[model samples]
Every structure is written in C-alpha cells, then in structure tokens.
Target: MDFDLPESAAAVREGVQAIAREYDQAYWDRCDAEKRWPEEVWRDLVAGGWHSLAIPEEYGGAGQGLLELAVALESLAEGGAGGAASFMYLLTPAFGGLTIARHGTGAQRREFLPRIASGELETCFAITEPDAGSNAIEIATRARLDGDHYVVSGQKIWISGVERADFLVLVARTIPAAEAKPRTNGFTVLLVDVKEAVADGTLSYRPIPKLGTNTVASSMVFLDEVRVPAERVLGAPDEGFAVLWDILNPERILAAASGVGFGELVLRHACDYARDRAPFGRPIGTNQAVAFPLARIKAQLELARLMTHKAAWLWDAGRPCGSEANIAKLTAADAAWQAADRAFQTYGGMAYSLEYPIARMFRDARIAKNIPVAEELVLAHIAQHELGLPRSY
Candidate 1:
C-alpha cells in the first residue's frame, strides 16, 4: 500500500518535469495549430534519457521497468508541454521497441534495438483495419511467404505517427481466419521498413485529419505487394496474437498514466480559475457548484492514479494484469474527460480562447475514451473475465 513512487521513479519524474517545464503552453499551442510534431520537446525528453528508460541495457537502453516509464510519461503530460500527441509519440517505443526486445530474435534485436534506444529511429504500430476496429481475428491484411520474403497486402486506418516513424511494427495474417486451426493463431507481426516500402511503391499513406492530438498525425496506410524479408518476422509465423500482449498491456498502462496526468492538469486549471475569478463579491470557488465538481474529480483522479500504478506494478512483476490494465484505462479515461468538462465549464467563455490550455486539454481528453481499447470493450472484458459471465462477442 505504498502510495509514493520509489526514489528511482522520483528521480525520473524530477528529470522529466525539468525538461517539460522548459516548453511553455504557447509552444504546445503552436504545434497543435501547425499540426507539427514537437521535435524540440521530443529531443528534450530524449536528452533527459527518459526515452530509453524502459529499454534493456544490452540494447543501449537503461533497462528500467514499466513503473519508471509511466512516471516519466505522467510527469511530462502534467508539465503542460506534452498534450495527447506527445504522450502518444512517447508511447510508440513502449508498444513497438519493447516488443522487439521481448520477442524478437537475437539478430532482430541487434539490428533495431540500438537505433531505437538512441531515439534515432521512431516506431509506429498498425493493428486496426478498414473492417476490423477491435477484432484482430477479423482483420483482412495477409502476408504470403515467397522465397526469402513475405508479400503483404492490406489497408490500415487510424495509424498514428506513421510519417514520423522509420519503421512500423505491422500485424498481418499468414493464415486466413476461416482457414486457420485457431482464429487467433493466424496473425503475424513484421518490422516493415517504411522508407523502402514507399520507395518501391508498395506502401502509401495519407494523413487522416483529426480533431485533437494534432501534434502527431494519424494516417490511413495502404500496403500492396510489399515484400519484407522473413528475418523481419517478429515471432513465429501465425503466433502474433500472443506476441501482441507485449504491446497491448504496456500500451494500456501508459495510456492510463497519460489520462491521469491530463486530469490533474485540467483540475489544476479549474482550481486556479475558481480561486481567482470573482463574480458575486467572492471567488467563484466559493460556489458549491464549482468547488464540489473539482473536489470530486480530484478524489477520482487519486483512485485512478493508484490503479494505473498497480497495473504497471503487476506488469513489471511478470504477472497477469489483463483485468487491472483494462480497469486502469477505463477509470483514467472517465476521470480525465470529466475533469476537462469541469474545467471548460469553470472557464466558460475563456475556455474557448486559445490562450488558455483548457480547450486543448478537453479535446485531447476525448481520445482516451476510445484509444488502444474502447470503453465498451473494457467493460465487456470485465463482464466476461471478472464477473464469470459468458463472452458476448
């Protein structure tokens, strides 16, 4: 029941916060307005060594655990420099590079890990398709083995940071869902070289215009006749479904941490406004309406933060954390959105102004409800796994 972060994590938080504080709200606002990647902010974070905190030491990473990385990400988000886009960019390594470290071959690790650890290479992951949003088993992407290469073809939507990435951790099926011995056993992950695929005209991408989190653009990707060497296969052929856990579990935990930090930032803004804005001879915070919602949101965020840490702890301990991970994201997502809503209400007209960060926080908070795993899907997992109910889908 230790509520505090360990000294190591506290040090990470301190370093991350120091870098984050250097970038002001206006800098983030400019990035959003221009739809530009926060390269300066990314460089600052990498310079702080937070980028390689979770990578194994042999691969030139610091060999830290999920707990340490989550603390760094949370601190970054709360610092007002990294909104949803920066948070999402930082998460790419957790989902992409960490998987390579865990399940990739010795050669595969040697080829990619060092570049990834140095932040010289950016990674993006693709899982969703035009047809299958959450159902990985139903995806239509297929890879055919041909001599030393696998020829791949499919369309992927809502892929984040594809343009910024040197490569993509791609998911495709070697065996069709209908033809496989087990539906889940038909998929495979490949480390696809983006520049090579594009150079050869096998891959094409177009940025998908989004509402918020514009710092990192999400895009639609097309792959046709893309050929990747067999050596690039991440794990055993048709066993990628199991390997995906290496990405998904950490993704949920980090996403939870991002939302938790966002909620706290929103509450801080709301509280500041409530304490200073006076309308009826006293600060608006004197009104129960303003004070109560902020109070309640603070309480909920505390619980959500605890669940986030617990999920990270279980994951770092090499224990099964499927239930905890799902609940952590679900809890944090709801709290983040509610806190944003309260802040927007507290600021009223000023919230619409770009000068304040509330509008951006509100827009970014909306994404947490549907990212990595949707709220409905998490509830379904809890219903089936935790409540002893039969699977619905």
Candidate 2:
C-alpha cells in the first residue's frame, strides 16, 4: 500500500540528480555529436559512489538493491542524459557487480567484487546473437572443455560498452540445444578477460553504426577459440538458466526505469516548448490538442514507473518477478516512445534541429522498444505466463 520510495532510494535519486545537473542538455548534445562517452559525468558518479549501489557493503559497496539502482538510473535519464546514461550503471554495477555478488563463487567474489565496487573494473553482457536475437536458447556460441580451460568461439551482436569492459559475462553452450535433454540445460555462463583475449587475438569487435544513444557504442563482438579459465564459470556449469534470469530480470527493470525517465524528460521539454512558443495570440499549450496528449503520456509514465519500482522491489526481495518485469518493460517502452513522438510534434519543425535536445532524445527513446527485449516478446510473455495461455513462439 505504501507508494513512496524508501528513504535510501530517495537519497540515491537526489545524489544522481545533483551530478546530472552539472551536465546539461548542451553537454549531452556535444557528447552525442562527437559520439563520445560522458567521461566527466562518469568520473563524478565514480567519486560519488553511485556506481556501487548494487554491491554488498562487505565488498566496499553501499549494500543497496535493484530498487536503489533503478531509481538512480531513472533520475539520470530524467535529468537530461536520456536512456543512454543508464548504460553507465547497467554495464558494471548491475551486470558485473550484482551478478557476481549473488552468483559468483567465493574465489570469484574475492577477485572481482572489490574492484568492481571501486569502479576499477567494468563488464559487458554478451548473449544476443545475430541469428538468435530474442531467443537466447538458440544461441550457437559454444564453449568446450579443454583441461582446465574452456575454449569458446562465438559471435555476439549489439553488445554495449565492450570497448571499456574489463570482463564479459558471456553465455555459451556446453551442449547444443539440439543435444541437451531439456532446452535450458547445457548452457554455461563464463567470465572472459576481454583485454587478454583481445591481446592474444582470440577476440575482436567492430562498433555497429547506430542511430542514437551514441554515448556508448554497441558492437559486433567475435570470439575465436577464446580460452577461459574453468574457474571463471559464474554459476554451476550447465545450469546457467538461473544465472541468465538473474541478469535479465534486473536488466529489464533498469531498462524500464530508463524508459520511464526518458518519457519524463521528453515530456518536460514538450511542456516547456508548448507553454512558451506563441505563433498566434496565445501559447500553443492553450489548445487541448497540445496539452491532452502530454497529460495522457504523463499518466502512462507514472504508471510505468510504478510497475518498474514494483519489479525492482520484487527482485530485491527474491520473489519471482518475470511477469512484472516484462510488463514494466512493455508499458515503459510504449510510454517513452509515445512521449518522444508527442514531444516531436509539440516542437513542430524545430524537433529535427540539433540545437535542441529533443532530436537526440527522440532517437534514444525509440531503441528502448526494441533492445534489451522487444515489446512484442514482452506481450507474448504476459500472454503465456500471466494469463496461463498457451505459449506462443
């Protein structure tokens, strides 16, 4: 019944907002124009310890949960950086820190968590393949046992932040989907040393030309006979479905937060422009056409944000949240896209101009519907799981 955010989560939002204020829309425009990472803001986040929200205090982190992390990302997006800024937290803290903190073996935790907490190391997730796309079970990446090492070879597409990642949380098959007894069996999650693999010529990547969110590069990563230590297996070998879900649910929740935040950002811009721009006797916002859609989107954004918080809370409480996560992602993506489209309309011809942040935000809001998980797939999940309908695809 309680709807307010916890005091700790509110503190995270305030802290991230303070940092985000230093980097205005103009700063983000420059970074987007140059296709550069927001290093200054990143360093500020590092100094503020925002990066360690999901890690355990025992490992030098704030010992927070996904709710706090989601709030931080939401605040960052609403602040002006858009959904792209969420990558700063998604790559290292959620994918690298939270996963290891929960599923990593004792030795693995000892080696990675402290550095991850300190922001000295970063990680990227590689699961989506060109052929497989949303169907992770069909991924052909293979890792074969070779003495104490697993020799891995595969290609992953649309991997984010690989250029800066020190490690890769890679999903590969020990046994092909065709050969495994259960479809989910035989999957293994490995932590690959990115620099070492690249130096030895076993790994390579090329950035894919993307429309928006240029702040971080999504790349086509190829691993050719990469050798990973056997000790690097993240969870129980051949039982990686659990680990994958652990990674994916939080990812969807954070993506949902990003969507909700982006919606708020664009809606704010649209409202500002609608109130001030007066081509006629009165402001454009005086028209219900201008004001109603924005108002409707505002309602949708708040609902999506509430679901996002619920999903995050369920995750932090170790409750099953697959349905909530998917719903949050679906509703939030729709809200963000609608908000951006409305904002574009509100700006009239000026939305296309780079002088305003609307153009960049318009582009960034779109990919949320497709990436992390597609809106259609999310709907299908709800159809099957929530309603107990027969599975589709």
Candidate 3:
C-alpha cells in the first residue's frame, strides 16, 4: 500500500509551509503574549488562496476536500503557530465552506461559499452549551419558528472566533428532547448573521480567560430571541442530526491534524535543543533518558499522523469514519501532550522561560485533549461502538 500523500496534499503542505515559515516562533509568541490576532499570517493565507482549497470550483474555490484542508492545518502547525493555528482553517473552511458546500441549499451555497472562498467572510460554529458539554443530545438551545423566521435563544460555551465571525452555524432544538421520541430527533441547524444579531442586541458574548492559545479568544455566547431567516436553515428542519455528524467528523479530523502538527513542532524543538546543549561534556541527546523518550514520542507522533490522514481520507471518500476520527483525535491529543511534556523536560528549567517557546506550546498542546471532543468521550465511544459493548452513557 502506498503511504505517501497525494500530490494535491503535498502541494498544500508546501504552500502553507512557505507562508507559515514567514512568521517565526517569536512572532507567534508575541501574538500569544499580547493576546493579538495574527492578521499578517491570515492576510497571507487569503492571498495564497489556501482558504479556497475546500470550496468547490463552481464557487470560486479549488474544489478540494477535507484531506487537503487537514494537511494545510497540520503543515501550518508544524511550521510555526502550533495547535492554535488550526482555527485558521477550522473556523471558516471546515465549518463554513465544507458544511455549506455539502448540506446547504443552492441559494445558501451561492450566498456563502464564494465569500468564504475569497476570505471576504468568516464563520464560527456553536454546538456545545453551558450544560450539555459532550452530551450534545442534551442541548437545550431552542429555535422556534416565528412566521418566516426562527427566534433562537440559548447559551453556548467555549465557542471560538465569535468576535471576528460574520456568521454562526448554530445548532438548536426545534423539538424539545423530552418530547422527541428519538434522542437525536427535533434538532435544527440555523445559520445566524452575527453582526446583525449583535447590533439588534439579541446576541452577546463574553470572552473566557483561558490558560493558553491566547491568540484567539473562546467565549460564552448568549443568544436571546435572535431572529434567523427561515432560508438560513442549513439542512432539513428538525432533521439536523445527520448534518451535525458531517460537521463533527471533519472537526475531529482537523483537530487531530492540529495535535499531530503541534507534536511535531515541539519534538523538533526538543531534538534541536538536545543536540546543541552539551552541559556535562556530552550532548544531553546522547543520554538514553532524553534520547529514548523523544524517540518514542516521535514514533507516537508519526502513528497519530497516519491515523489522522486515514480519517481525513475516509471523510473525503464519503465513508463512515466515526471510529477512525475518534481514534485519530484521541491518539493525536495524547501524542501532542506527551511530546510537549518531554520537550519541556528535555529543556530542563529553560523551558519555563519566555525566551523559549516550550511553555507556550505546552499550553497550546493541552486544550486539544478536551475541546472539540474530550479524550474520555472518545474512549467511551470506542469502548461501546468498536468493542460491541453495551452503552455506558
């Protein structure tokens, strides 16, 4: 079997790498420290047309798929920005472009895809609620029909990029969970105009202070009687569980890519430092203690990356990829955390200093273990679904 990336994915890597290289670790460090967005890198990505990779050619895009988008995110993380940079691809192309391209009506496609392709607009996803957390079926966000529009009210937590987003892909309940026969029934997906809702005072958000990935803000979003046009329904009303799956699988795969890339970034830094810093008349890398753990982490990184690629490929092929996606995210998150921990250990106390990027990377690498999908939930899925065991939750 061929293990190589397709030519298209290779080209995506090269293109994104060229841009990522322009922004050094110091640049990212400054951005994180100042809690600033990397506008320069974003402009360069737009200029390079990387954002258009997933948009269909008919909609002013390159007509690529999730595999290529995952590659772009991974390469960008490995190149410099760490796992935090995955938002560049996740917020727009994966969540907006791919979802709308596949599930949106023709008019919806026409309205959003081209703008997304051209980087003229940005979108954020909102699914997790203050109480729901990983139990998405328990979400209480409600969107009731009001004539031609749906009046939505809900609270969403840990939503990324809301401040900068022009649009939001919102998941709400048209039928209350208690009333719906099947747990997944009664769900509806709506596309809300963020700026309009905010201006009307129906939508507001407060940023949550976080431990890392300070470059982009995550917020607690409140939607109170927000009106969304009926035309903005992303999929068939009250049958959005299927649409939610499509969005979720891609999210897991891209997040896996981010973890693998972040692992590579930290591992590279560890290897470089280990080879150069010789304190006791020999490079620390020469010792088995430092050398062996790095080697093991390198193996883990490669294995996780392979699973990530397989998940993305399965998604592009329109195959059932839930098992693969969960596995990829779980393994990649563990690998990234291990790599960051070892890298920090390899650098000794110097890792704590701001002069080095390890502390920042360590902080960034950690969030992947919990967000998008938690490691414990992934394990639960595998335990029940893959093993054919009884449901635990």
> Which has the better lDDT: candidate 1, or candidate 3?
3
Give the TM-score of each candidate: 0.97, 0.99, 0.99
lDDT string for model 3 (1-393, tens) is 889999999999999999998888999999999998889999998888897798899999988999999999999999998976789889988889999999999999999998988889999999999799999999999999999999999999999999999999999999999999798999999999999999999999999999998888999999999999999999999999999999999999999999999899999999999999999999999999999999999999899999999999999999999999999999999999999999999999999998999999988888889978989899999999999988888
Model 1, residue pairs in steric clash? none
The per-model lDDT (C-alpha) reads 0.86, 0.93, 0.93
Candidate 1 lDDT by residue in tens digits, 262-316: 8888888899999999978899999998899899999999998899999999988
**Candidate 2's residue-wise lDDT over 34-147, tens digit each?**
989999988888888898888888888899999999999999999988877779879998999999999999899889999987778999999999999999999999999999
Off by over 4 Å in 3: none
Number of the candidate with higher TM-score, 1 or 2: 2
RMSD of 3: 0.7
Q: 357 in model 2: Cα distance from truth in Å?
A: 1.2
Candidate 2 Cα lDDT to native = 0.93
